[model samples]
Target chain A: MTPGPTPGPLPGPTPGLRIRGLVKSFGGRRVLDEVDLVVERGEVVSLLGPNGAGKTTLVSVVAGLLRPDAGSVSVLGTDVVRAPRAARGRIGLAAQDVAVYPTHTVEENLRFFGALAGLRRGELRTSVDTLLETLDLTPLRRRRARELSGGQQRRLHVGCALVHRPRLILLDEPTAGADPQTRRGLLRQVRALADDGGTVLYTTHYLQEVEELDARVVVLGDGRVREDAGVDQLIARYTRSELVLRFSGEAPELPWPGARVAGDTVFLPTDRPGVDLVKAVELTGQDRERLRAVELSRAGLEAAYLELLGAGRDE
Target chain B: MNRALTVARHDLVWLRRDPAPVITMLLTPALLMFFIKPLYVGALDRLGYRGVNGAELAVPGMTVMFSFFMAGLVTESVFREHGLNTWARLRVSPLRDTELMTGKVAPCLVLVMAQSCVLFLLGRVVMDLRVRGSLLALLAVMAALSACVVAFSFLLCAVARTRRQAFAYERVTTLVWVILGGTLVPTELMADWVGSLAGFTPVYWASHGYREVILDGEGVAGVLPHVGVLCGFTVLFVALAVWRFNGGADKQHWD
Candidate 1:
């Protein structure tokens, strides 16, 4: 099946999106505060934030849905505010909410949206056929959108956005209701898009998806971008592995920088787990025998996200 | 124009898939024609409407009245997109504001015409209601009536933020049109002040033209003035809706 536009080498060296000092307010409260972001082509950036963290506000500005009070937004080098139709034509947005037509059949919903996105009739049919198979919605193509279960509807929602094969996709919590299989398939398609030199800005609460896609993580909180780095870099910077020693008796006082005693056990957070463990054991002296068991907990992206937004925010 | 028609077809496709509009259009008119026709026939005789069968007056009048109820379907066509989470998707399409407005109003226009046909035909075949006026003049008036109501419905859809709000507005409009505009009872029978006020409602002009066609056998000469009034209301409502939508584009998005 023929794919949608390849977005290969767009005019004037257009990156995916370049946002500068964007700000938006609602009822005297700034929902997006001087936000700045840049996602180049062939990059998959996962935006992570708790509810009401302004992740929605940031992308909505880029998608040309809401105008920012200040700063500039450019999609593929075209000003989104000045050239809205041109910028929006290159962008596909799958919202946190399922936006497919409920009463229209699955096939109808996809083709209708694809046509609006300016897909030719023949190409639209082929692309839809491929999406139905790729998303595993082929069997339900004839069924009305409302007849699908939660998981099926989620896939259809994402499929509508992809049918146009947009160069830059801004997907917000696209995997919210998908089953495990569907989620995996959807991620595979996202991976394929990046591999095809397309750019993606994905927002999700699931850190596992970030890890699987190996996406660069950008965190939003308090109406601003809190952090932007590769997933591995974020995990390494924010969270360190921990070594816990369960003692049969009261553990001896350890001089390690991050060592604390709780009942008969000691919890130590260290950058070098092996070296710190040796130091702690040597310091235990005669109490070393009291160390009945040792356990190591590796740090993950979830830890980094918590460390970043885990401050005194209402989420 | 292409985008607008495509959007309109998309909406119509969904509306067809849902049985609610179809059942309401078919059943509601049939029920009103059969049950209300007899009551009006007796009631009109008591009220001194002796020259014409009450079914002819009641059917066209009630048809015009219930056509206002078509506002419900029109509003639903729009508000339901937001409910189903698709409004933002539609907005981002490469459509001009005029195209979007056309797309929105097109299906409502088609539906109102269909509804008029159903109610008028049910009166003719089922109740033996005869056309005393020029059929062409009556057809032109009905066509204008449909367009006027459709425009009113489109304005209501554009102004309403939610389904509940649209329903409330439609309810109030229905009451005003039925009581004040002579859709429920003859305007001549109402008090002098009420009759004077009825002249202001577009529905009064629409059904009043229907009365000329059904009772007085008037041709285009008689129906032209009423049709002109209906056209005026259509233009007024549509122009206001377009102004609201185009001027408030950012507000609609941020909302």
Candidate 2:
């Protein structure tokens, strides 16, 4: 085979991934439109979106599996559109679907993908072995993928992408349908990949995963990047904790401002649950006997994401 | 090239893990040749070949007919990638579309060739079937026929929306070619119109090439015309396959 173009030294430390005015359409429906994002090296960015929000389409375009209708995506220093082969060489993508060959053993799947990634014999062997251990698939290495449980297969699917130790890893909902053990292992591996200077772009609807990774979150809604910031920042900006007082019977109204009652409960949105809880108990007065329980619902990434998407939809 | 080889090797491993379909293809043809030899012997006698055993006819006929069935291996392999959702992963790899197609089809070609040659070898050893002509000529015909079958399989894959559609086309086409091309009954025994139409099929060219080498004692130079015709069919099939195939198109693995 003839050698391909050799990459020269970069002018500076290039962003792990850079996208500008990216657009994609399917059957006249715009799936992605003017989406812009940048992720630096050693960073883990969680791509959160609802169904049909074009998260998968964006990932496909970045992985070079789908041609963009317009705009540009560059991995490290290679343009994904013009030099797809060179760009693909630097990216490892594990799509949302489990793509492992069922008839092949766990080890064989890893070896085959690692070989295709241009790893030499020794390096390939080492990488496969390390992945088998990291994904906790060592014990099941010789088992055919068809015989393994769904979680085991899911782990193997992610392992195939990491077997080559790529500089940029694109994992789309890697933990979807995974068991708790499998999810924990994958989250640890993903975090470790980023901590070791690998850039990771993860997509999932599970906001807790984003919080667990402590990743910078990018919320995609209606074919655009609606929110891009740290998880804490998003929660502070878009979410608010709620204080609730449940009643066993017809309850007295709370004096708390902006409190709303529904069914047998009163919900008071709060930034300070401690002071609000005290105010709620005092306001109940003679009807405090009807108060069955007082509960504080802490604000989290899930709430923030829901609020952000809801507001975007409202717009 | 290395990437294509990697894909080819992986395919070979899949075959190794599940050998039932291949074993059936090989054994069924060999068994049928034995049972059908006496019928061919009588036909050969009536044609004025006084002492010719039926192996001369039964061997090549069975070989040509079953090689068409071997096209299933190609369709099955390609469609299985879709079923497993691995097609997207493969496309995302560094391998180009040309290399991926080459890697996927190369093994099917080798398997078809091996299946045809093995059936002929069984005839020579067990039935005293002699190749009176150049062995090189026999091999050339087998190579050409195998290439034609593999190319035809790719065309089926490109045109069929589902695996069931591809298999249905394969079975129907193989049966039509085998009957018209004189695999079961000699073309001369059929109606005059059937004999004329037989020449239109690739199977007819393959059967003619094998007969010239094994029965007519033809050398490589004597069989070049038949080989050239089979190669022509191969080129036509490849051209159609290339035109219709869309690597990015969504194809169903099963109905």
Candidate 3:
């Protein structure tokens, strides 16, 4: 196989991926509606959405696996639907489900995909060997794909996608069902790939993963993008307040503003917890010695996601 | 072409690892030729057919029988990859559909040719069957038969939605071809109408053409009709297969 011309630094103003008014429907239900997003080179964009929000559909369309009913998708400034082969050559997708052949060994799967990516025989062999080692699959290189554990298989699937060193990698729930160690390891690789100037588009239900990567999060609801911002910006925009307070003798009843109590605990969604605490002590006539532990907390992306979904339901 | 050949090489490696199909491809023709010749001889003697012996008829029939087995094996193997979404992935690559289709057909043709050669050699060495016609005519017949099988196998792959369905369809088709095309018994023993009906089938035409070349001392022109029919079947089946192949690259169901 001959290597393609060294993709000369993705010319022009196009980011790694650019989508405009992308729409798709299944049966009568609209899965993606006017979805627009972009991921610049070396940036990690996390697509966050609840179930049935069309994350997978969007990814599949961009990967050239499915055709969208409306809108246009461009990867590296090339129209994907119009010229699938040229568009797909620069993009790699690691599907949520394991896609490797069960009877083929890990090395075989990597080499096969590497060749598909237009790697020469020498380059393919070297790349496959390097990936096997990097992904910690060297020990199981000879084992058939089906024999590996789920996490191992997941790692191998990602390795296959990376063998070609594509410019943009799309991962649809790549780390789902993986243990903490495996998940972290995969994340590290993903982050490193981004750091190496490769764009990444990932989707997952794991809120913490979005937080950990600090990626630009696009919250999807009802087939539309509800929010797109940095993780901290999203949290700051949606989270209103923080509160920290303590009570004595099985948690004293404090008439705190904007507070709700259950059993001995009082929950307050407020911005000025220190003011609320002083007021609560005066209102409840509780001495300072009776106070227990008090802590302040701010809302996270999880809270924003729930709020977004709740708002979508009401609309 | 390189990408297409790469896919073929990958499949060949897997086939090599699992030797059962290779063994079946080689052994089935030999075993059928060994047992059917004596039975055919007894029946032909009873019918007062004095000019030709059983081994002569059995040799050509075995060649036709091998085509059926090769077709079924190729269908099952290729459809297994299709069911697994491997073909869909390859389709999205730079590899053209024609390349992928050619890669699949090439392997089946090679396997069928090898089987035909083994059957011919066994017939010559063990049964003293004479090759009276030009070797080119014999090769042309074998090539036509293999092409017919490959076309049908690809058609089967197109219609088969799952590996299990492909396997079942292949088995049924192979058995039907073997039985109806007179692989086990001489077509002469059947009713005249039955023999005429068998003429319409590719396997029968292939077997009859081979018999004409190897047994009847006829030139290629004498078996032109048989060759023509087999070629027609090949074209018709390949066209249908290509039609079914269009728009099949969808999101594969991951299991």
- Ten residues in a row with the worst lDDT in model 3 chain B? B246-255
lDDT of candidates 1 onward, in order: 0.81, 0.88, 0.78
- For all candidates listed, what's the TM-score of chain B alone? 0.91, 0.98, 0.89
| Sort order, TM-score high to low | 2, 1, 3
Q: Over all chains combined, what TM-score does candidate 1 have?
A: 0.89
- Model 3 sits at an interface RMSD, in angstroms, of 2.0
Comparing only chain A of model 3 with the true chain A, what is the TM-score?
A: 0.88
Q: What is the TM-score of each predicted model, taking all chains together?
A: 0.89, 0.92, 0.89
Poorest lDDT segment (10 consecutive residues) of candidate 2 chain A: A1-10
lDDT of 3 by residue, B85-159 (tens): 565456545666677777777788888888888888988898877777878888888888888888988887777
Q: Please, what are the lDDT tens digits per residue for candidate 2 over residues B37-132?
A: 988988887666666889999999999988989889888988889998888888777878778888888898999989988999899999889888
**Candidate 2 lDDT tens digits, A83-178:** 988887788889888999999999999999898888879999999988898888999999999999999999999988888888889999999999
Off by over 4 Å in 3: A1-12, A249-257, A270-287, B42-53, B82-88, B183-186, B247-255
The candidate, 1 or 2, that scores higher on lDDT is 2
Report RMSD (Å) for each prediction in the order shown: 3.8, 4.7, 4.2
The prediction achieving the highest DockQ against the true structure is 2
lDDT of candidate 1 at residue B17, scale 0 to 100: 65
DockQ score of each predicted structure, in the order shown = 0.60, 0.70, 0.47
